[model samples]
Target chain A: MNQDILVKAIDVTKNYGHFRALDKVGLEVARGEVSCIIGPSGSGKSTLLRCINLLERMDGGAIWVNDELIGYRRDGNNLHEISDAEISRQRRRIGMVFQRFNLFPHKTALENIIEGPVQVLGEAVNEARERAMALLERVGLADKANHYPSELSGGQQQRVAIARAMGMRPDLILFDEPTSALDPELVSEVLDVMRNLAASGMTMIVVTHELGFARNVANTVTFMEAGKVVETGLASEVLSAPRSARTAEFIKAVHS
Target chain B: MTTASLTSSMSSTAETKYEIAHLRLVPKRHVGRMVAAAAVLVLLAALVRAFSVGQIEWSYVRDFLFAPAILDGLANTLLMTVAAMCLGIVLGVIVAIMRISGNPVLSSIAIGYVWIFRGAPALLQLMLWFNLALIFPTLGIPGLFEMRTVDVMTPFVAAVLGLGISQGAYTSEVVRSGLLSVDSGQYEAARTIGMTQMLMLRRIVLPQAMRVMVPPIGNEVIGMVKLTSLASVIQYSEILHNAQIIYFANTRVLELLLVASFWYLAVVSVLSIGQHYIERYFGRGSKSIRSSI
Candidate 1:
């Protein structure tokens, strides 16, 4: 409801057959703030994040990004709305990093980073390459720029994925368990990069099980259980000492 | 100190005993495998001898296989195989895109094409097109207000069309399976970066899918090489047809048939080898990593 919010979801619901993946979920993300969502496996955290990008369409309610209404295209009375192409174009402004570090396997890290800029933004190839090099350096993977995904370690690949997302110059970045698939020792490297991004004032929404990073980096931490947000507040308040029984139980489970 | 040394000696002996036991078991397993393999080899040799005993005519086979006309037919066979495969791959890519397109009508049209061609016997399809003159006297052109009849459906034209179209259907499904083999996440990744669907397909999805799809497609190419022999039925005068004409006139059925078979085998062997190298080239980077571990 805040005018300063970059993203607002009002009573958003997503249904699959008779099951409700997200039930009347409402949330808002303000400009230049990192919001971390923490939940159990089936708690619909991912569904909520995906709905923000219209990757998964919401069954009810409204979503606005930069005050532009999402999921509907007004026509002359008929309202022939929500084409895939339109959603894809909107998705450009909201970059998403998957749990699996979904870098294009066939392309080198440099090509992966430059692909979106050159192809979608119509930036010249050389310009895109230069920007991609800077991004790769920022992600601490300047040396590994020419390496393919298969040739890199999981941690390295995830960094390349971050660089790829950053290359698009999106308004917000969505991270779906970015470090969950990484090895224990490699987790810190990705978290360190994320911390740097956070410090630099990049708006990010991360769905992660790394409570340590979540506590250290996120401005707001939301706790959800079974398709509903149980508690959301300042990271230290929610993560260190949750209010609701469900949030407390989740914290206990994660910590233990 | 004496007691400690005695205990250590006992433990060392125990470890040696366990090692001996393991080593003794290994050779027994090895001997059993060797004996089983020997039996298989004996059985295979007996079967080969039985099948090949008096059927082969060494001299006639040697002479006919290397004949000038047969060699020419072999060249023609290879030419058609390469040309058809090149054309089929291009057509296959187009059809695969159509099949996966967002438009329902275009998708259905692609599905219908694959279904009709794949369901019908390829030989029958070839014959039908070759004999299409009987079914439709004229093919009407609407805008130009002209009609071109059965006279246009010459055997060569029909053969190429028939083979190419049928090959396209099978190749499309091959390509589609390849495309589908790529992770949907890759497409999403590319799109998020703002890559157009076409560019994404070209640079990301297709390259990866082609790696997965290559072996089956290579099989299709080899199969197409042999399938071109079907053109002989429509009097298209490919290798097999040319052989048939020579054999009928000379009345040397087995010898001439052998010549055709030899040529087919030779060309297919070369193509199969080429396919192996191609697959290896793509596989090398992945394979080295796997093998090193």
Candidate 2:
């Protein structure tokens, strides 16, 4: 484990019944790295993101954030599962954006952004509000501070979700297909926000089918096949001249 | 402010019209609705005539409808309804949460509670509560103050316990459904945001769930108002009980029953109107009231 590695998963295994979702997988993301995981459907790309956040627990192996083991504590050689309170405390350090853009429909855009900071971290209400406003402005939705999620378009909602994750000031943000649910025309706005965030040196792990965004914004690209990382390299080389037959086949299929 | 500008609203207009149209009517057959209305009116007119002009003694009913004793009974009935519903809703929320808490012990206890209270008849439960002394002669703790069970189990206390516990059983089901109505994504969002269970329920889950919970709960509240009449069976001195006592003495059973029925109808109508407004209030942020519980 390099000290510079912000997130590291060593031989992490997960199973749903007889199906192995993650078959002894390993991944490491350095601080300020924008790493993209690209794969076909059911290739465990989303499952990997979920495991990193402890939204779905891995049946075997362990995950670490910074220097701390996530969702568990090391006791001698045995690993003891931590309390939900502890898991949530760790989760506060990481932000996640869902495929469905899971904004709280009951609250306005500003309220949604401020909810995590004020409610979880106990930040001052006014402070959280001001920070939320700034993030909304950064996302180009400052004017929509009072708009409920139901009133927002899918692109606008995903942007707010991004701002909301940014409002946490998290060390890393995990995006699981954030633009999958948007209209083809609307995908550009969400991708633009991600590009800006990556350019500003935010650490991010994005699982996406959008090869263009992956190539344009991601520094590192990892190709996954059947719950295993098959290829890893710089985004340009991986997309243009991949070394694995599996990766080449997938890229050709996607391009065609 | 944020809109899905992927597609704009379309506008259209009719450019040409050739002919003005008139609605056609078939006059060969009588309208079913008209026939039904005529039948209903005649039946209602006959019933009203029978009640107003028959030997039920309308003057006795009119005199005692607003009498001091009858008014006192009405007051007692309203008090019982409010107090019992308050207890029921509070207990119901706890039980509903327990039922869904995922802890086997808590959920089993909640299930057993709903089963017993809902399974037994209300009248029987009331009687048991009133005579609770026979089963538990004294209510107390070791090294603490003690009192006779019968002394504590007054008719008023017994009535509230019986009606409220039963209502709580029904309300728990209604509340559980309401809680379930909220999307699971909301729960996950709260969890990912590092919200505790209590705060998640208070701020995120319940606010959304209330939109679905209000209408059925309003129905329960009105139902409780009528349910208080069962208190009279235990001599709780509510509206029906007062009427019963007066009729028992004066032998004006029909007149007394009519007054109670009128009051019941009046209270239910008022509660229904209140329910409509409350539903609208919680229904905000959504498109329409089409998804009401």
How high is the CA lDDT of each candidate model? 0.83, 0.89
Fnat, 2 decimals, each candidate: 0.53, 0.55
Worst 10 residues of 1 chain B by lDDT: B20-29
Give the winner by DockQ: 2
lDDT tens digits, residues B250-291, model 2? 999999999998888898999899888888777766766635
lDDT of 2 by residue, A107-144 (tens): 88999999999988999999999999999988899999
The residue-by-residue lDDT of candidate 1 on B1-293, one tens digit each, is 69999999999999888775445443345888889999999999999887578566667678877778777777767766777777778888998999999989989999998888888887898898988878787786767665665677776677777787888899999899998988888777776665657777887788877877789899998898899898889887788988888878977777778778887888779888998777765553353534654
Candidate 2 residues lying further than 4 Å off, grouped into runs, are A1-3, B1-30, B290-293
Query: Which parts of model 1 have CA positions greater than 4 angstroms off?
Result: A1-3, A75-80, B1-68, B86-112, B143-147, B281-293
Clashes of 2: 0
Mind giving the per-residue lDDT tens digits that candidate 1 earns over A50-150?
88887787898778888877768766765445765776688788888889999887678999888888877888999999999999999999999888788
